[model samples]
Target: MASYKLYYFDGRGAAELARLVFKQAGVDFEDIRYTGEEWPQHKSEMPLGAMPVLEMDGRKICQSLAIARYLAKEFGLFGSNNMEAFLIDELFEIFAEIMNSHLVKIYYEKDEDKKAEIAETFKKDSAAKYLNLIEKRLKENTSGSGFYVGSEVTVGDLLLYNSMYGHRKWLGKFGVDVYEGRPLLEEHFKLVGALPNIKKWAEERPETAF
Candidate 1:
């Protein structure tokens, strides 16, 4: 089997979607993690001065989105047509934007009061925009089928699940339970989480305290 080495921080911040995609595809790979202290020294060796680098067949790749799309294409999670791939990319960008904004406030904001305000606004805006969009997408997918993006699971579903899971964990500090009014999204989360492959992977994977 082809294998990969994924280098990232100890937490599941940026690299998690890739991790989950690999697990769902049941591809065996090496997961390399670093601490904050170790990352500075480790940074120069990476392709783009960034963590979350994925190496396959001795070739290194950078940028979480590029790495994710490559893995998804390899694992058959990408949509079948150019149009579908374009749609997949669109969804990926939406989730990425939302996640980045929340992470920035959490990591960069200096004032406690301002951080709280930012987080609350993040939860509201993200929930209102991204979650609602996902809810609509899932409802459309619900024609007696349990897949998002197509007749079967695709990269979009996995990425959305990881984002929702991360948001649920991250927003808890602000007391923003993400599932309060979004029943469709809650069901979507549960549906994706209960995938037999995903559930088993979650059980075997090393738990990272996000």
Candidate 2:
């Protein structure tokens, strides 16, 4: 077994995908978290002066997306070929864009009322727009099979899993159920969640709030 250690803040913001991947792969690894105070001293030691670093075989890797892709490829979660992997990567990139847009207010917004306003606008415009597009893609990808991107589970599925679930909470806070109008999306979420390995991983891990 490889020596795998994932370093991050004690939240689901960036490292969740990697964690889920490791869990679903039934890999035993160390999960290390740090607080704001501890990060400054630790930051200088990191390769990129950042959190969410994954130390594989004692070699440190940086960047959440890069780490995710590396692990996906390592664990066979990435698609089988270059083109298929590229397609999975493309969808993952799209999810990253959506998360980056809304995460600004999540960590920095201080004013209660203004933050609520921002969340509401984000939900209606950015989040809704992406979900609608994803719903259409999901409907089209349903060529007698339910999975997205390919016939088998891929990195794209995990990326979409995080985005859809993350935004659902952000949307609900604004009185909008993110899945309200998207039955296909709901089914998609359920299918991802019901992946036997993923469901077992989720259940065994301590309940984590994003």
Candidate 3:
């Protein structure tokens, strides 16, 4: 077995997907969480001066999605065929765009008025449009397994669940509910939550304000 060590902040943020992947794969790896006060000292040590670096067998891998993709392939969650992998990659990209372009901006917007305005726009436009598209894709691709890709769970499903989980956790204060009117998504969320390994991970993982 290869030695693995993941370094990230105490909060979930970008590292949650990788953490989930590890847990779901039944892998034993070191999860090193840093405090805000302790980050500066370790920041320069990271390959890209960022958190969520995964050190595998002494080689460090930076970037959250890159690590997640590597773990997904390692854990057999990348999908069964070329077309399935392509679709899974597409969904992951779409989720990342939504997070970086809309959700993260709204979450960190400090000015009250500006935050409210951006939140409103996100709720009305970005959230609504993209969430509906995801719901439709899930409904079309789901073969009663509640997974976004094939009959088995894939990185696409993990990405969608983590993205929505972040939205609900951070944007709820602004009264943003992305699952509204999306029953398929809501059901999918429940299904993912109920997965044996995921349920244990959720129950055991530290609670954070992410």
- After superposition of all CA atoms, the RMSD between model 2 and the true structure is 2.2
Error of 3 at 2 (Å): 1.4
Off by over 4 Å in 3: none
Best by lDDT: 3
lDDT of each: 0.79, 0.76, 0.85
Model 2 lDDT tens row, 1-210: 689999998877788888878866677779898977888989987998987899878789999888888888888888767766776776776777766777476547777677678776776777777777777666766444577766787767877777777667665665655557678877877888999878886677655566
| Lowest summed lDDT window (length 10), candidate 1 | 140-149
Q: Of models 1 and 3, which has the larger TM-score? A: 3
Instruction: Kindly report which residue stretches of model 1 are placed more than 4 angstroms away from their true locations once superposed.
Output: 101-103
TM-score against native, each model: 0.90, 0.87, 0.95
- lDDT of residue 82 for candidate 3: 93
Q: Which is the winner by TM-score between candidate 1 and candidate 2?
A: 1
Candidate 1 Cα deviation (angstroms), residue 179? 3.8
By TM-score, the best candidate is 3
Query: What digit string (tens of lDDT, one per residue) describes model 1 on residues 1-210?
Result: 566999998878788889888988889889999988898898898988997999888988998887888999999999777766876888887776765756576668778777678777776666577767766766665445556666777888888778778877876766767667777666767888898888887677667887
RMSD of each: 2.0, 2.2, 1.3
